[model samples]
Target: MEKFTRLTSVAAPLAEADVDTDIIFPARFLLLLDKAGLGKHLFHERRHRRDGGMTDFVLNTPPFNEARILVADANFGSGSSREQAVWALADFGIRCVIAPSFGEIFFSNCFKNGVLPIVITGEAHANVMAAARTGQPFTVDLEAQTVLLPNGPALSFDIDPWRKRALLLGLDEIGGILADDAEDISAFEARHRVDNPWLFLDDGRMEQLLSQGDGK
Candidate 1:
């Protein structure tokens, strides 16, 4: 996961609401086991026609193709609990997604995968959508929690302190737990071993178990 301190690049505007996981990365693409190469498949159905010709979608057009930020309407990332949606967005070089609201599962998955899903309303959302339409670049500063508009004004947004820290350090859930409490984990393991000595095998027994292949 890459640290998301600040991102300044062209934003693509998708003013449609309820842009679900299927629309973002169709279910057929989920057969892919690895996160690599999903970018090309991002918004696959919308970007391609039945004959494999490209459609006039925003992402298929110029300038927006290289967009690093996405400004979308409310209820962005709405159906299904697919983490691949985040993977596809990240692979496509979109570091941040600004919307009026997001599906709860999608919102949580974004942080885990290094995508910043920002919730903004009123003036902030309007300004970002306007900037994106003009193909102007905007900046999202996670540390400062501000979205800098092209013209002048900066819009502030809120993020949970721990999630913000995790993004800055590029730590996933397990990585964060280990980094923050390695000592505590070690201590707990030590105590567990002492309290449940029968769980541990002697050298002779361990070797026997290994030789048998199946521990039982």
Candidate 2:
């Protein structure tokens, strides 16, 4: 996962509510666990018509096609709690998504996958979307608690300190846990074998394993 200190780029407006995970990445494309090729499948159903032509989706536009930041409306990720929604968005080059609200499960999934789900006020969101639609680039400064819009004043927003740290360091729940006590893990494993001899059925098995490689 890549560190996400700050992101400055053109933000495309998706301007829709209750945009669920299934619409973000249709179930048909979930065949592959690896998210690398999922970008092409992002909004798979909506982007293409029954006649096999491009639809009127916001992402189909040229300016929004290469957008890195997405400005969307309330209840951004509402329906199913599929992790693939975050994967598809991140893989599609959308690093951050600004919305007034987000589905609980989808919000958590975003952080775990290195996508910053920014919750902003409705008024501020409108301002950002207007700028984005006009082809202006904006800067989201996580450290400064501000979003700078092109040719306009900066917009202030709030973000939880803990979430900010996770995004900045690119540390997911598992990554944070492991980084917090890597040394303690080694010590605990050593003590576990000694305290519960029967747990390690083979005698000296644990010690031999420890001696064969670096403790880490």
Candidate 3:
């Protein structure tokens, strides 16, 4: 996992509403197990022609091709839960996404994958989208919970404190658990081993037990 503290870069504007997971990663590519190299397939259909050539999609062009932020329309990332959608965005160097609303699962997945998904509505959303269209650098700071638009003042966004911490530390759920309870876990293991030494069998103890069982 990668930590997402702040991102200041040109944002690719995806004005389409309800851009679903299936469209982001595509069902056909679901068979791909590895998350690496998923950037090539992001928005596959939209970025490709019927003849398998490149289209003039925003991401296929200059500046946007190297975009690290995305400003999308309402209901972005809606549809079936496919974590690869977030993976694709992350693999493509998108560390932050701004939208009016997001799919419940997709929004959750973003935090797990080290991508900051920000929700802004009304004039703020419109302004961000407009700035993104101009291919100007937009800054998203997880620490401050703010999005610095190209022209206007930074707009505030809300996020769960826990999720914000996880992203800041580049921790997944299991990593978070380990980090939050490392001392407790170590102390518990020491106590458990003393209480149940049989459960802590080493190679020699296991071999001795096996030999005794065989003799019996």
- Tens-digit per-residue lDDT, 10-53, candidate 1: 99999999999889989998899799989999999889999979
Candidate 3 lDDT tens digits, 38-145:
988899999999997999999999899999988899899999999999999999998888999999999999988988999999998999989988887878888999
lDDT of 2 by residue, 1-216 (tens): 888888888888888888988888887767779978788888998898889899878888888888999998889988888899899899999999999899999998998888888888767788887888987778888878788988668877777777778778889888877877889998999999899976876657767776777665
Candidate achieving the largest TM-score: 3
Q: Global lDDT of each model?
A: 0.92, 0.85, 0.92
What range of 10 consecutive residues in model 2 has the weakest lDDT sum? Answer: 207-216
Q: What is the lDDT of residue 96 in candidate 2?
A: 90
Score candidate 1 by TM-score against the native: 0.90
| TM-score, structure 2 vs. true | 0.86
Q: Model 3 off-target regions past 4 Å?
A: none
As for TM-score, the candidate ahead, 2 or 3, is 3
